[model samples]
Target: MMRRKSWQKNLKIAVAALLIIYAVEHILTMNVYLRKPMLFSPLFRVYNQSGSEPHCPSVRLSTRVLPQIALASYPGSGNTWVRHLLQQMTGIATGSIYNDEQLRHNGFPGESLSNGSVVAVKTHNHYAGKDYARAILLIRNPYESMLSLFKLANSNHTGEPSVDRYGKQWGTFTEERIRGYIPLFASWIKLQDVLPIFYDALKQNLTRELVRIKAFLGQSGIKGDVRCALRDSEGHFHRKETGITLEFFYSKKQRMAVNSVIDQMQKMFKDRFENIREDMDTWKL
Candidate 1:
């Protein structure tokens, strides 16, 4: 009888605590659903209510008073993750030119980076735009980056494949693909002011990178919680389980293929690729 009474008390406490949390969520997003109807789900709702979302908040953060900044990278290089991190940090919308229709589901609409006087333009093109002041180049491990791209491409239902699905499987890479990657990898050098962000370094130590990034962007004093930033960057990903990377997902043959490609890249790019491979500590995941 005493145990039963204790159980009832715990249940009541749990119910009260849940109610309090729900009330808070509702208040934050109650009327917001109409304005930003995408602000449904009381659980993950956050809004500035007055402003539009951005396509690439970090890239377009105008270092100058005029013109836009380009956020350039090859697809699957964690550019989307960077966009999400920026959103959580600044409550600004981070969007993609290609995926605007889908970005809205995550609170970043098609016009997230539009309608603003100053914008951050994001592109996968290997070239720079004439109108931009400068660019921020984001990089990632080729094997994992290719895997991410493979999964993304295979998932696209549009029959045409998304982001140019490179090969038949996760681990199997190509000479042609590697050749394409070399140019994209090398393209960062063209920008007058390029801020190179490596994915492996970022996932391992985001707070440190973010500090560096904010300072590079001339907004070093921007106030935000490190815990929250980490949570947003780590959790906001649709494929956060870490199973899809080269470490586990790729087969022996696939790994061999990746190694050959890496060797080729290392021979060609030298320290640019090798240094990152050495720093490729993925323990944070």
Candidate 2:
């Protein structure tokens, strides 16, 4: 009888402890839900409360059929930031060809193959065998873009790199990255339905550029709250300016080499922007 009583008491204590934990968790979840309704919202479906402006628009998969459009850019050319802006403006999640775990966990739930469900798929590769019906080519100055990539690589894709991190390896890295631009731009330039968006232009006028993008995507029907999107324009992955200077990435010799490549890229764009008469096979990748 004594052992039975002890066993019953322990079982009761364990049951009570579980109940307490459940209650605490429920309370906490409720608190979060009340404070930020967007936090608990689902990613694959739109959620809009009646007669109230949403705190943050819920990102959803495309409800209507859409073309497979790519948001193409070199790494560190503000691709993630542009996706954030578009997500806010459209309430549709963007996709990516490469699945980035960090991006999937963060805002981009659609981090897979470029498909109709996503508004636009992000990509860095524009070589042969990589083709899309339409593309938004995001261009940033080579120097800043390459430096940004270096920082991202060093800091695990979210932070700036330390000055001490710069060394001999960076020089080689810089050369390789700068060379990559030629083929990337060349491939995209051949596309008939491509929108070339400069990074600086977007910074200067976001709303105007968004309007252009919306028209191009044939999404003028959906009324996106531009003001709300603009409220937090700088998205999660944007690395702010830091004290670490990036001048050491290139020496005078390296600068000349980089500039020569830049000149060739400009010549290609200028010569073939309207007419892609030049044979693509001849261009060295």
Pick the lDDT winner.
Answer: 2
lDDT for model 1 comes to 0.55
Candidate 2 lDDT over residue span 166-270, tens digit each: 887688788788778788988887887788776866775665566667777764244465545665666788777776444545788777766777668668766
Q: Single out the weakest 10-residue window by summed lDDT for candidate 2.
A: 36-45
Which residue runs of candidate 2 sit more than 4 Å off their true CA positions? 1-56, 127-131, 219-225, 244-246, 272-285
Residues 1-285 of candidate 1 have per-residue lDDT tens digits of: 999999999999999999999998897565545332122233442323354332223322333242355667777777767766655554444434465555556455433453233334567877644655566678776766665666566763122244344335332444345557767756655555666777766755566676656665554233333334444464344564443344555556555655665565455444443244334323212
The residue-level lDDT of candidate 2 at 205 comes to 62
lDDT of 2 at 16: 100
Q: What is the C-alpha RMSD of each candidate to the true structure, in Å?
A: 10.3, 15.1
Q: In candidate 1, residue 269 scores what lDDT?
A: 45
